[model samples]
Target: MFAKLPLIDYQPLKIIDIAQVYCTLTHPHFSNQIITDIDQEINIIANKSQITCQQSIPKHEEELKIIAVVKQLLTNLPKYSYPKLSLKFKRIISLPGKSDQAIAYFQTDLLTDSISTDLIGGKLNLTYNLNSCPLYFSLQSALIRQQDHRLLPALAFEGEFAYGNKDPREILQIINNWSEDWLTFKEIINQGFLG
Candidate 1:
Protein backbone atom coordinates (compact mmCIF):
# COMPACT_ATOMS: atom_id res chain seq x y z
CA MET A 1 0.00 0.00 0.00
CA PHE A 2 1.25 3.50 -0.89
CA ALA A 3 0.30 6.79 0.77
CA LYS A 4 -0.92 9.76 -1.22
CA LEU A 5 1.41 12.76 -1.19
CA PRO A 6 0.43 16.38 -1.55
CA LEU A 7 1.71 18.43 -4.49
CA ILE A 8 3.03 21.74 -3.32
CA ASP A 9 4.39 24.55 -5.54
CA TYR A 10 7.06 26.94 -4.28
CA GLN A 11 8.75 29.44 -6.59
CA PRO A 12 9.97 33.01 -6.75
CA LEU A 13 9.02 35.40 -9.55
CA LYS A 14 9.66 39.10 -10.10
CA ILE A 15 7.42 41.84 -11.47
CA ILE A 16 9.29 41.74 -14.81
CA ASP A 17 9.25 37.96 -14.99
CA ILE A 18 5.95 37.56 -16.76
CA ALA A 19 7.25 38.34 -20.20
CA GLN A 20 10.24 36.07 -19.71
CA VAL A 21 7.95 33.29 -18.58
CA TYR A 22 5.70 33.75 -21.61
CA CYS A 23 8.61 33.79 -24.03
CA THR A 24 10.32 30.74 -22.51
CA LEU A 25 7.13 28.72 -22.20
CA THR A 26 5.94 29.57 -25.66
CA HIS A 27 9.24 29.23 -27.51
CA PRO A 28 10.70 26.38 -25.42
CA HIS A 29 14.39 25.33 -25.66
CA PHE A 30 15.05 26.74 -29.19
CA SER A 31 18.70 27.35 -28.31
CA ASN A 32 21.00 29.92 -29.90
CA GLN A 33 21.78 27.50 -32.71
CA ILE A 34 18.10 27.19 -33.55
CA ILE A 35 17.69 30.94 -33.46
CA THR A 36 20.72 31.46 -35.69
CA ASP A 37 19.38 28.87 -38.13
CA ILE A 38 15.98 30.53 -38.31
CA ASP A 39 17.56 33.97 -38.71
CA GLN A 40 19.75 32.72 -41.54
CA GLU A 41 16.79 31.13 -43.32
CA ILE A 42 14.77 34.33 -43.13
CA ASN A 43 17.77 36.33 -44.34
CA ILE A 44 18.19 33.99 -47.28
CA ILE A 45 14.57 34.53 -48.23
CA ALA A 46 14.88 38.33 -47.95
CA ASN A 47 18.12 38.38 -49.96
CA LYS A 48 16.42 36.33 -52.65
CA SER A 49 13.57 38.84 -52.83
CA GLN A 50 15.93 41.80 -52.98
CA ILE A 51 17.97 40.13 -55.71
CA THR A 52 14.87 39.34 -57.71
CA CYS A 53 13.75 42.94 -57.39
CA GLN A 54 17.18 44.30 -58.27
CA GLN A 55 17.57 42.07 -61.30
CA SER A 56 14.19 42.97 -62.68
CA ILE A 57 15.97 45.28 -65.18
CA PRO A 58 14.80 48.91 -65.35
CA LYS A 59 11.48 47.99 -63.71
CA HIS A 60 11.11 50.87 -61.34
CA GLU A 61 8.42 49.74 -58.95
CA GLU A 62 10.29 50.59 -55.73
CA GLU A 63 12.16 53.49 -57.31
CA LEU A 64 9.86 56.12 -55.88
CA LYS A 65 10.07 54.61 -52.44
CA ILE A 66 13.88 54.74 -52.48
CA ILE A 67 13.97 58.22 -54.01
CA ALA A 68 11.41 59.56 -51.55
CA VAL A 69 13.35 58.22 -48.57
CA VAL A 70 16.61 59.66 -49.90
CA LYS A 71 15.10 63.06 -50.65
CA GLN A 72 13.39 63.18 -47.30
CA LEU A 73 16.69 62.70 -45.50
CA LEU A 74 18.47 65.11 -47.83
CA THR A 75 15.85 67.73 -47.00
CA ASN A 76 17.01 67.82 -43.37
CA LEU A 77 20.77 68.05 -44.07
CA PRO A 78 21.16 71.69 -42.95
CA LYS A 79 20.25 70.78 -39.37
CA TYR A 80 23.29 68.80 -38.09
CA SER A 81 26.98 68.58 -38.91
CA TYR A 82 29.46 65.73 -38.31
CA PRO A 83 33.14 66.45 -39.03
CA LYS A 84 34.29 62.79 -39.19
CA LEU A 85 31.60 61.55 -41.50
CA SER A 86 32.75 59.61 -44.59
CA LEU A 87 30.60 57.96 -47.26
CA LYS A 88 31.19 54.80 -49.31
CA PHE A 89 28.94 52.17 -50.85
CA LYS A 90 28.65 49.45 -53.52
CA ARG A 91 25.80 47.70 -55.28
CA ILE A 92 25.64 43.90 -54.82
CA ILE A 93 24.83 42.83 -58.37
CA SER A 94 25.51 39.12 -57.83
CA LEU A 95 28.39 39.46 -55.35
CA PRO A 96 29.89 42.99 -55.44
CA GLY A 97 33.02 43.20 -57.58
CA LYS A 98 36.64 43.96 -56.58
CA SER A 99 37.35 47.43 -57.97
CA ASP A 100 37.14 51.17 -57.18
CA GLN A 101 34.95 52.18 -60.12
CA ALA A 102 31.79 52.61 -58.03
CA ILE A 103 33.33 55.16 -55.68
CA ALA A 104 31.25 58.34 -55.58
CA TYR A 105 31.76 61.98 -54.51
CA PHE A 106 35.46 61.38 -53.72
CA GLN A 107 38.59 60.61 -55.71
CA THR A 108 41.22 59.37 -53.26
CA ASP A 109 38.80 57.47 -50.98
CA LEU A 110 38.17 54.25 -52.84
CA LEU A 111 36.34 50.96 -52.26
CA THR A 112 39.08 48.55 -53.29
CA ASP A 113 37.15 45.35 -52.56
CA SER A 114 33.92 43.91 -51.20
CA ILE A 115 32.75 40.53 -49.95
CA SER A 116 29.58 38.76 -48.82
CA THR A 117 29.91 37.61 -45.24
CA ASP A 118 27.93 37.06 -42.05
CA LEU A 119 29.42 40.14 -40.44
CA ILE A 120 28.12 42.97 -42.67
CA GLY A 121 25.79 43.47 -45.59
CA GLY A 122 27.83 42.21 -48.53
CA LYS A 123 30.85 43.35 -46.49
CA LEU A 124 31.94 46.56 -48.30
CA ASN A 125 35.57 46.63 -47.13
CA LEU A 126 37.37 49.78 -48.24
CA THR A 127 40.72 51.57 -47.77
CA TYR A 128 40.79 55.35 -47.25
CA ASN A 129 42.30 58.21 -45.27
CA LEU A 130 40.69 60.06 -42.34
CA ASN A 131 41.48 63.67 -43.15
CA SER A 132 39.65 66.48 -41.37
CA CYS A 133 36.87 66.59 -43.94
CA PRO A 134 33.39 68.02 -43.41
CA LEU A 135 31.37 64.85 -44.07
CA TYR A 136 27.74 65.50 -43.16
CA PHE A 137 25.84 62.96 -41.04
CA SER A 138 22.35 63.45 -42.41
CA LEU A 139 23.30 61.48 -45.51
CA GLN A 140 23.41 58.34 -43.40
CA SER A 141 19.81 58.81 -42.42
CA ALA A 142 19.01 59.22 -46.09
CA LEU A 143 21.00 56.15 -47.17
CA ILE A 144 19.63 54.03 -44.35
CA ARG A 145 16.08 55.03 -45.21
CA GLN A 146 16.77 54.82 -48.94
CA GLN A 147 17.84 51.17 -49.22
CA ASP A 148 15.82 50.12 -46.17
CA HIS A 149 18.73 47.74 -45.65
CA ARG A 150 19.16 46.07 -42.29
CA LEU A 151 22.38 46.55 -40.25
CA LEU A 152 23.83 49.87 -39.11
CA PRO A 153 26.11 52.10 -41.21
CA ALA A 154 29.15 51.09 -39.15
CA LEU A 155 29.96 47.72 -37.62
CA ALA A 156 30.46 49.25 -34.16
CA PHE A 157 27.30 51.42 -34.33
CA GLU A 158 24.69 50.51 -31.77
CA GLY A 159 21.38 51.87 -32.99
CA GLU A 160 21.01 55.69 -32.70
CA PHE A 161 21.35 55.85 -28.90
CA ALA A 162 24.91 56.15 -27.62
CA TYR A 163 27.04 58.08 -25.05
CA GLY A 164 24.01 59.97 -23.65
CA ASN A 165 23.26 61.71 -26.92
CA LYS A 166 19.94 62.31 -28.73
CA ASP A 167 17.88 59.21 -29.25
CA PRO A 168 18.04 57.93 -32.83
CA ARG A 169 14.45 56.83 -32.73
CA GLU A 170 13.34 60.35 -31.81
CA ILE A 171 15.28 61.90 -34.66
CA LEU A 172 13.73 59.30 -36.96
CA GLN A 173 10.30 60.21 -35.63
CA ILE A 174 10.89 63.88 -36.42
CA ILE A 175 11.95 62.95 -39.94
CA ASN A 176 9.00 60.61 -40.38
CA ASN A 177 6.53 63.29 -39.33
CA TRP A 178 8.02 65.80 -41.73
CA SER A 179 8.24 63.35 -44.64
CA GLU A 180 5.26 62.94 -46.95
CA ASP A 181 4.78 59.42 -45.63
CA TRP A 182 4.12 58.77 -41.97
CA LEU A 183 6.01 55.84 -40.40
CA THR A 184 6.77 54.52 -43.87
CA PHE A 185 10.51 54.97 -43.44
CA LYS A 186 11.77 51.68 -42.06
CA GLU A 187 15.54 52.21 -41.99
CA ILE A 188 17.86 55.04 -40.87
CA ILE A 189 21.40 55.03 -42.25
CA ASN A 190 24.37 56.11 -40.14
CA GLN A 191 22.96 54.55 -37.02
CA GLY A 192 26.27 54.90 -35.19
CA PHE A 193 27.31 58.30 -36.56
CA LEU A 194 28.18 60.91 -33.93
CA GLY A 195 30.31 63.98 -33.39
Candidate 2:
Protein backbone atom coordinates (compact mmCIF):
# COMPACT_ATOMS: atom_id res chain seq x y z
CA MET A 1 0.00 0.00 0.00
CA PHE A 2 2.89 2.37 0.73
CA ALA A 3 4.02 2.06 -2.86
CA LYS A 4 1.45 4.64 -3.85
CA LEU A 5 3.08 7.41 -1.86
CA PRO A 6 4.70 10.05 -4.08
CA LEU A 7 7.91 10.16 -2.09
CA ILE A 8 8.11 6.38 -1.80
CA ASP A 9 7.60 5.98 -5.54
CA TYR A 10 10.19 8.52 -6.47
CA GLN A 11 12.10 7.44 -9.55
CA PRO A 12 15.64 8.57 -10.17
CA LEU A 13 16.56 10.35 -13.40
CA LYS A 14 18.24 8.48 -16.26
CA ILE A 15 21.17 9.30 -18.52
CA ILE A 16 20.30 9.90 -22.15
CA ASP A 17 23.66 9.54 -23.88
CA ILE A 18 25.79 6.44 -24.03
CA ALA A 19 28.96 6.69 -21.98
CA GLN A 20 32.13 7.24 -23.99
CA VAL A 21 35.32 5.63 -22.73
CA TYR A 22 38.80 7.09 -23.10
CA CYS A 23 42.38 6.34 -22.05
CA THR A 24 45.89 7.73 -22.47
CA LEU A 25 48.98 5.62 -21.94
CA THR A 26 52.54 6.97 -21.60
CA HIS A 27 55.53 4.81 -20.84
CA PRO A 28 59.14 4.43 -21.89
CA HIS A 29 58.84 0.67 -22.17
CA PHE A 30 56.88 0.78 -25.47
CA SER A 31 58.85 -0.51 -28.45
CA ASN A 32 58.65 1.06 -31.92
CA GLN A 33 57.27 -2.12 -33.42
CA ILE A 34 54.60 -2.46 -30.73
CA ILE A 35 53.47 1.14 -31.28
CA THR A 36 53.32 0.66 -35.03
CA ASP A 37 51.33 -2.56 -34.69
CA ILE A 38 48.75 -0.91 -32.43
CA ASP A 39 48.53 2.17 -34.61
CA GLN A 40 48.05 0.03 -37.71
CA GLU A 41 45.24 -2.06 -36.23
CA ILE A 42 43.51 0.54 -34.05
CA ASN A 43 40.98 1.46 -36.72
CA ILE A 44 39.37 -2.00 -36.73
CA ILE A 45 37.58 -1.26 -33.46
CA ALA A 46 35.13 1.40 -34.61
CA ASN A 47 32.60 1.53 -31.79
CA LYS A 48 33.69 4.29 -29.40
CA SER A 49 31.45 3.10 -26.61
CA GLN A 50 32.53 -0.55 -26.81
CA ILE A 51 36.05 -0.62 -28.20
CA THR A 52 38.25 -3.70 -28.22
CA CYS A 53 41.61 -3.96 -29.89
CA GLN A 54 43.03 -7.29 -31.04
CA GLN A 55 46.57 -7.14 -32.32
CA SER A 56 49.55 -9.48 -32.55
CA ILE A 57 52.08 -8.66 -29.84
CA PRO A 58 55.76 -9.24 -30.47
CA LYS A 59 57.97 -11.26 -28.16
CA HIS A 60 58.51 -9.56 -24.75
CA GLU A 61 55.62 -7.21 -25.61
CA GLU A 62 53.56 -6.25 -22.55
CA GLU A 63 49.94 -7.28 -22.61
CA LEU A 64 48.51 -3.92 -21.56
CA LYS A 65 44.97 -2.75 -22.21
CA ILE A 66 43.06 0.15 -20.71
CA ILE A 67 39.32 -0.43 -20.40
CA ALA A 68 37.65 2.93 -19.95
CA VAL A 69 33.98 3.36 -19.05
CA VAL A 70 31.81 5.79 -20.96
CA LYS A 71 28.18 6.00 -20.01
CA GLN A 72 27.37 2.32 -19.64
CA LEU A 73 29.76 0.97 -22.28
CA LEU A 74 33.20 -0.57 -21.75
CA THR A 75 36.07 0.32 -24.03
CA ASN A 76 39.11 -1.94 -24.17
CA LEU A 77 41.88 -0.04 -25.88
CA PRO A 78 45.33 -1.46 -26.45
CA LYS A 79 47.82 0.71 -24.59
CA TYR A 80 50.96 -1.41 -24.29
CA SER A 81 51.88 -0.32 -27.78
CA TYR A 82 51.79 3.43 -27.25
CA PRO A 83 54.42 5.63 -25.66
CA LYS A 84 51.93 8.48 -25.17
CA LEU A 85 48.14 8.51 -25.47
CA SER A 86 44.94 10.12 -24.16
CA LEU A 87 41.19 9.43 -24.32
CA LYS A 88 37.99 11.15 -23.25
CA PHE A 89 34.80 9.68 -21.68
CA LYS A 90 31.46 11.47 -21.61
CA ARG A 91 27.87 10.75 -20.44
CA ILE A 92 24.70 12.83 -20.45
CA ILE A 93 21.67 12.83 -18.13
CA SER A 94 18.43 14.55 -19.09
CA LEU A 95 14.96 15.32 -17.79
CA PRO A 96 11.83 15.53 -19.91
CA GLY A 97 8.59 17.54 -19.72
CA LYS A 98 8.30 21.31 -19.08
CA SER A 99 11.88 22.31 -18.48
CA ASP A 100 11.30 26.01 -19.01
CA GLN A 101 12.57 26.64 -15.51
CA ALA A 102 14.99 23.78 -15.30
CA ILE A 103 17.98 26.11 -15.06
CA ALA A 104 16.69 27.32 -11.73
CA TYR A 105 16.98 23.85 -10.29
CA PHE A 106 20.77 24.01 -10.37
CA GLN A 107 22.62 25.64 -7.53
CA THR A 108 24.74 28.69 -8.13
CA ASP A 109 27.70 27.54 -6.08
CA LEU A 110 28.16 24.49 -8.26
CA LEU A 111 28.29 26.60 -11.38
CA THR A 112 32.05 26.84 -11.37
CA ASP A 113 32.00 27.14 -15.14
CA SER A 114 28.94 28.53 -16.90
CA ILE A 115 27.91 29.85 -20.28
CA SER A 116 24.67 31.56 -21.25
CA THR A 117 23.23 32.52 -24.60
CA ASP A 118 19.94 33.67 -26.09
CA LEU A 119 19.76 30.74 -28.50
CA ILE A 120 20.05 28.13 -25.77
CA GLY A 121 19.31 27.90 -22.08
CA GLY A 122 21.71 28.40 -19.19
CA LYS A 123 24.67 26.02 -18.82
CA LEU A 124 26.93 24.98 -15.98
CA ASN A 125 30.26 23.20 -16.16
CA LEU A 126 32.05 21.93 -13.08
CA THR A 127 35.55 20.54 -12.68
CA TYR A 128 37.16 18.84 -9.70
CA ASN A 129 40.76 17.71 -9.43
CA LEU A 130 42.26 15.31 -6.95
CA ASN A 131 45.32 17.35 -6.06
CA SER A 132 47.33 14.30 -5.02
CA CYS A 133 46.09 11.98 -7.77
CA PRO A 134 46.18 12.10 -11.54
CA LEU A 135 42.40 12.17 -11.81
CA TYR A 136 39.79 14.83 -12.50
CA PHE A 137 35.99 15.12 -12.76
CA SER A 138 33.99 17.42 -14.99
CA LEU A 139 30.27 18.17 -15.27
CA GLN A 140 28.46 20.36 -17.76
CA SER A 141 24.94 21.40 -18.62
CA ALA A 142 23.63 21.06 -22.18
CA LEU A 143 20.04 22.26 -22.26
CA ILE A 144 18.75 22.93 -25.72
CA ARG A 145 15.61 21.96 -27.61
CA GLN A 146 16.05 19.90 -30.70
CA GLN A 147 14.24 20.34 -34.00
CA ASP A 148 11.19 18.11 -33.60
CA HIS A 149 7.47 18.15 -34.16
CA ARG A 150 6.82 17.65 -30.46
CA LEU A 151 8.16 19.80 -27.63
CA LEU A 152 11.15 17.91 -26.26
CA PRO A 153 13.67 20.12 -24.55
CA ALA A 154 17.11 18.60 -24.35
CA LEU A 155 17.59 19.49 -20.73
CA ALA A 156 20.72 17.42 -20.35
CA PHE A 157 23.75 17.41 -18.07
CA GLU A 158 27.04 15.75 -18.85
CA GLY A 159 29.54 14.21 -16.42
CA GLU A 160 33.04 13.05 -17.24
CA PHE A 161 36.13 11.87 -15.39
CA ALA A 162 39.69 11.29 -16.53
CA TYR A 163 42.67 9.52 -15.01
CA GLY A 164 46.24 8.87 -16.06
CA ASN A 165 49.67 7.58 -14.94
CA LYS A 166 48.32 4.28 -13.58
CA ASP A 167 48.99 0.64 -14.33
CA PRO A 168 46.85 -0.82 -17.11
CA ARG A 169 45.51 -3.53 -14.81
CA GLU A 170 44.56 -0.99 -12.15
CA ILE A 171 42.84 1.18 -14.73
CA LEU A 172 40.85 -1.81 -15.92
CA GLN A 173 39.78 -2.56 -12.38
CA ILE A 174 38.59 1.01 -11.92
CA ILE A 175 36.62 0.86 -15.14
CA ASN A 176 35.02 -2.41 -14.06
CA ASN A 177 34.01 -0.81 -10.76
CA TRP A 178 32.65 2.35 -12.37
CA SER A 179 29.03 1.18 -12.25
CA GLU A 180 28.92 1.76 -8.51
CA ASP A 181 30.65 5.09 -8.93
CA TRP A 182 28.11 6.11 -11.55
CA LEU A 183 25.26 5.24 -9.22
CA THR A 184 26.70 7.34 -6.44
CA PHE A 185 27.32 10.22 -8.82
CA LYS A 186 23.78 10.08 -10.12
CA GLU A 187 22.35 10.17 -6.65
CA ILE A 188 24.54 13.12 -5.71
CA ILE A 189 23.60 15.08 -8.83
CA ASN A 190 19.91 14.34 -8.38
CA GLN A 191 20.12 16.07 -5.05
CA GLY A 192 21.08 19.29 -6.93
CA PHE A 193 24.44 19.55 -5.21
CA LEU A 194 27.41 18.99 -7.46
CA GLY A 195 29.73 20.46 -4.83
Candidate 3:
Protein backbone atom coordinates (compact mmCIF):
# COMPACT_ATOMS: atom_id res chain seq x y z
CA MET A 1 0.00 0.00 0.00
CA PHE A 2 1.23 3.54 -0.89
CA ALA A 3 1.27 6.34 1.70
CA LYS A 4 -1.11 9.25 1.07
CA LEU A 5 0.54 12.58 0.14
CA PRO A 6 -0.52 16.05 1.26
CA LEU A 7 -1.98 18.46 -1.28
CA ILE A 8 0.24 21.26 -2.49
CA ASP A 9 -1.00 24.83 -2.13
CA TYR A 10 -0.33 27.22 -5.02
CA GLN A 11 -0.30 30.98 -5.37
CA PRO A 12 -2.43 32.65 -8.02
CA LEU A 13 -0.73 33.46 -11.32
CA LYS A 14 -0.04 37.16 -11.84
CA ILE A 15 -1.15 38.80 -15.08
CA ILE A 16 2.35 40.09 -15.77
CA ASP A 17 3.79 36.62 -15.44
CA ILE A 18 1.23 35.24 -17.86
CA ALA A 19 1.89 38.07 -20.28
CA GLN A 20 5.63 37.55 -20.15
CA VAL A 21 5.25 33.84 -20.85
CA TYR A 22 2.91 34.48 -23.75
CA CYS A 23 5.16 37.15 -25.19
CA THR A 24 8.12 34.80 -25.04
CA LEU A 25 6.22 32.06 -26.85
CA THR A 26 4.65 34.28 -29.49
CA HIS A 27 2.11 32.89 -31.92
CA PRO A 28 -0.25 34.09 -34.67
CA HIS A 29 -2.78 36.69 -33.50
CA PHE A 30 -0.93 36.65 -30.18
CA SER A 31 -2.49 39.86 -28.93
CA ASN A 32 -6.05 38.75 -29.45
CA GLN A 33 -5.28 35.21 -28.35
CA ILE A 34 -3.59 36.38 -25.15
CA ILE A 35 -6.49 38.66 -24.30
CA THR A 36 -9.03 35.87 -24.92
CA ASP A 37 -7.05 33.43 -22.82
CA ILE A 38 -6.69 35.91 -19.98
CA ASP A 39 -10.40 36.79 -20.16
CA GLN A 40 -11.37 33.13 -20.05
CA GLU A 41 -9.15 32.58 -17.03
CA ILE A 42 -10.62 35.59 -15.26
CA ASN A 43 -14.13 34.39 -16.01
CA ILE A 44 -13.34 31.01 -14.53
CA ILE A 45 -11.95 32.59 -11.38
CA ALA A 46 -14.90 35.00 -11.19
CA ASN A 47 -17.47 32.24 -11.51
CA LYS A 48 -16.03 30.66 -8.39
CA SER A 49 -17.10 33.78 -6.46
CA GLN A 50 -20.82 33.01 -7.14
CA ILE A 51 -21.89 35.55 -9.77
CA THR A 52 -25.52 34.42 -10.08
CA CYS A 53 -27.58 37.34 -11.29
CA GLN A 54 -27.21 37.78 -15.03
CA GLN A 55 -29.56 40.02 -17.00
CA SER A 56 -29.97 40.50 -20.73
CA ILE A 57 -30.19 44.28 -20.39
CA PRO A 58 -28.00 46.35 -18.06
CA LYS A 59 -30.21 48.36 -15.67
CA HIS A 60 -30.27 52.16 -15.33
CA GLU A 61 -29.79 51.93 -11.57
CA GLU A 62 -26.37 50.42 -12.20
CA GLU A 63 -25.38 53.39 -14.34
CA LEU A 64 -26.53 55.76 -11.62
CA LYS A 65 -24.37 54.01 -9.06
CA ILE A 66 -21.35 54.30 -11.32
CA ILE A 67 -22.01 57.99 -11.94
CA ALA A 68 -22.39 58.60 -8.22
CA VAL A 69 -18.96 57.08 -7.64
CA VAL A 70 -17.37 59.41 -10.17
CA LYS A 71 -19.16 62.41 -8.72
CA GLN A 72 -17.98 61.52 -5.25
CA LEU A 73 -14.40 61.58 -6.47
CA LEU A 74 -14.86 65.06 -7.89
CA THR A 75 -16.44 66.24 -4.66
CA ASN A 76 -13.42 65.12 -2.68
CA LEU A 77 -11.10 67.41 -4.63
CA PRO A 78 -12.83 70.75 -4.06
CA LYS A 79 -9.66 72.82 -4.55
CA TYR A 80 -9.31 71.79 -8.18
CA SER A 81 -11.14 73.72 -10.87
CA TYR A 82 -14.56 72.35 -11.69
CA PRO A 83 -14.47 70.40 -14.92
CA LYS A 84 -17.20 70.70 -17.51
CA LEU A 85 -19.90 68.07 -17.47
CA SER A 86 -20.55 66.15 -20.65
CA LEU A 87 -22.59 63.00 -21.31
CA LYS A 88 -21.72 61.07 -24.42
CA PHE A 89 -23.23 57.79 -25.58
CA LYS A 90 -21.27 55.58 -27.95
CA ARG A 91 -23.18 53.39 -30.38
CA ILE A 92 -21.74 50.25 -31.89
CA ILE A 93 -22.94 47.92 -34.60
CA SER A 94 -24.73 45.15 -32.72
CA LEU A 95 -24.73 42.86 -35.68
CA PRO A 96 -23.00 42.40 -39.00
CA GLY A 97 -24.14 44.42 -42.07
CA LYS A 98 -25.84 46.91 -39.74
CA SER A 99 -23.36 49.74 -40.35
CA ASP A 100 -26.13 52.24 -41.07
CA GLN A 101 -27.78 51.63 -37.68
CA ALA A 102 -26.01 51.01 -34.40
CA ILE A 103 -27.22 50.55 -30.85
CA ALA A 104 -25.96 52.77 -28.05
CA TYR A 105 -24.18 50.33 -25.74
CA PHE A 106 -22.14 52.06 -23.06
CA GLN A 107 -22.37 55.41 -21.23
CA THR A 108 -19.03 57.25 -21.49
CA ASP A 109 -17.73 60.67 -20.42
CA LEU A 110 -17.21 62.72 -17.28
CA LEU A 111 -14.72 65.54 -17.84
CA THR A 112 -13.61 66.75 -14.39
CA ASP A 113 -11.07 69.52 -14.88
CA SER A 114 -8.06 67.78 -16.42
CA ILE A 115 -9.26 64.33 -15.43
CA SER A 116 -11.35 62.43 -17.94
CA THR A 117 -13.31 59.72 -16.22
CA ASP A 118 -15.13 57.51 -18.68
CA LEU A 119 -17.41 54.51 -18.31
CA ILE A 120 -17.06 52.36 -21.40
CA GLY A 121 -18.15 48.75 -21.90
CA GLY A 122 -18.59 48.20 -18.15
CA LYS A 123 -15.17 49.66 -17.31
CA LEU A 124 -14.13 52.86 -15.52
CA ASN A 125 -11.23 54.78 -17.01
CA LEU A 126 -9.47 57.77 -15.40
CA THR A 127 -7.20 59.56 -17.85
CA TYR A 128 -4.84 62.36 -16.76
CA ASN A 129 -2.98 63.82 -19.70
CA LEU A 130 -1.24 66.75 -18.03
CA ASN A 131 1.57 64.40 -17.05
CA SER A 132 3.63 62.11 -19.25
CA CYS A 133 1.23 59.18 -18.86
CA PRO A 134 -1.65 59.14 -21.33
CA LEU A 135 -3.57 56.18 -19.93
CA TYR A 136 -3.36 56.93 -16.27
CA PHE A 137 -5.76 54.52 -14.60
CA SER A 138 -8.35 51.87 -15.54
CA LEU A 139 -10.56 49.24 -13.90
CA GLN A 140 -12.48 46.60 -15.83
CA SER A 141 -14.77 43.77 -14.89
CA ALA A 142 -14.20 40.46 -16.66
CA LEU A 143 -17.54 40.30 -18.45
CA ILE A 144 -18.89 36.94 -19.53
CA ARG A 145 -22.16 36.09 -21.24
CA GLN A 146 -24.60 33.78 -19.53
CA GLN A 147 -26.67 31.16 -21.28
CA ASP A 148 -29.61 33.58 -21.24
CA HIS A 149 -27.41 36.26 -22.86
CA ARG A 150 -26.92 38.05 -19.59
CA LEU A 151 -23.48 39.10 -18.23
CA LEU A 152 -21.50 38.14 -15.15
CA PRO A 153 -18.81 40.46 -13.81
CA ALA A 154 -15.21 40.13 -12.57
CA LEU A 155 -12.73 42.88 -11.68
CA ALA A 156 -9.33 43.71 -13.21
CA PHE A 157 -7.02 46.74 -13.04
CA GLU A 158 -4.59 48.22 -15.57
CA GLY A 159 -2.52 51.40 -16.07
CA GLU A 160 0.58 53.06 -14.72
CA PHE A 161 1.26 54.75 -11.38
CA ALA A 162 4.53 56.61 -11.63
CA TYR A 163 6.07 59.43 -9.61
CA GLY A 164 6.91 62.58 -11.54
CA ASN A 165 7.77 66.20 -10.81
CA LYS A 166 4.61 67.36 -12.63
CA ASP A 167 2.35 65.44 -10.21
CA PRO A 168 2.44 66.73 -6.66
CA ARG A 169 1.48 64.71 -3.59
CA GLU A 170 -1.94 66.40 -3.47
CA ILE A 171 -2.72 65.46 -7.06
CA LEU A 172 -1.46 61.95 -6.45
CA GLN A 173 -3.67 61.74 -3.39
CA ILE A 174 -6.69 62.58 -5.55
CA ILE A 175 -5.77 59.83 -7.97
CA ASN A 176 -5.24 57.38 -5.13
CA ASN A 177 -8.57 58.30 -3.59
CA TRP A 178 -10.24 57.86 -6.98
CA SER A 179 -8.76 54.39 -7.29
CA GLU A 180 -10.08 53.42 -3.89
CA ASP A 181 -13.50 54.77 -4.85
CA TRP A 182 -13.33 52.80 -8.05
CA LEU A 183 -12.78 49.60 -6.05
CA THR A 184 -15.82 50.38 -3.95
CA PHE A 185 -17.80 50.97 -7.12
CA LYS A 186 -16.63 47.63 -8.45
CA GLU A 187 -18.02 45.90 -5.37
CA ILE A 188 -21.35 47.61 -5.93
CA ILE A 189 -21.44 46.59 -9.58
CA ASN A 190 -20.48 43.03 -8.61
CA GLN A 191 -23.30 42.86 -6.10
CA GLY A 192 -25.75 44.37 -8.59
CA PHE A 193 -24.86 41.65 -11.07
CA LEU A 194 -24.79 38.88 -8.48
CA GLY A 195 -27.80 40.01 -6.49
> Best-fitting candidate, measured by lDDT?
2
Candidate 3: tens digits of C-alpha lDDT, residues 1-195 = 112111121112112101000001111222332211222222111121111111111233342232333344346634443222211111111112222111111221212334433433445566545342243445443543447985433234444333232323443354334334334434432343212
TM-score of 1: 0.17
Worst 10 residues of 2 by lDDT: 1-10
Worst 10 residues of 3 by lDDT: 17-26
lDDT of 2 by residue, 1-195 (tens): 001112222134434533334443333332332221234523224332233333322222233232212212223335332221223333444445455434433332323334333323455455545332233344444454456644433335445545545555566566566545445445545554422
The deviation in Å at residue 39 for candidate 1 is 22
- Whole-model lDDT values for every prediction: 0.20, 0.38, 0.28
Q: Model 2 clash pairs?
A: 19-70, 19-71, 20-70, 24-85
| Collision pairs in model 1 | 144-189
Candidate 3 has what TM-score? 0.21
Candidate 1 ranges with C-alpha deviation above 4 Å? 1-67, 82-86, 93-195
* TM-scores, each model vs. reference: 0.17, 0.46, 0.21
- Model 1 local distance difference test score: 0.20
Per-residue C-alpha lDDT of model 1 across residues 16-71, encoded as one tens digit per residue:
10000000111222233221122221111111111000111123333223223323
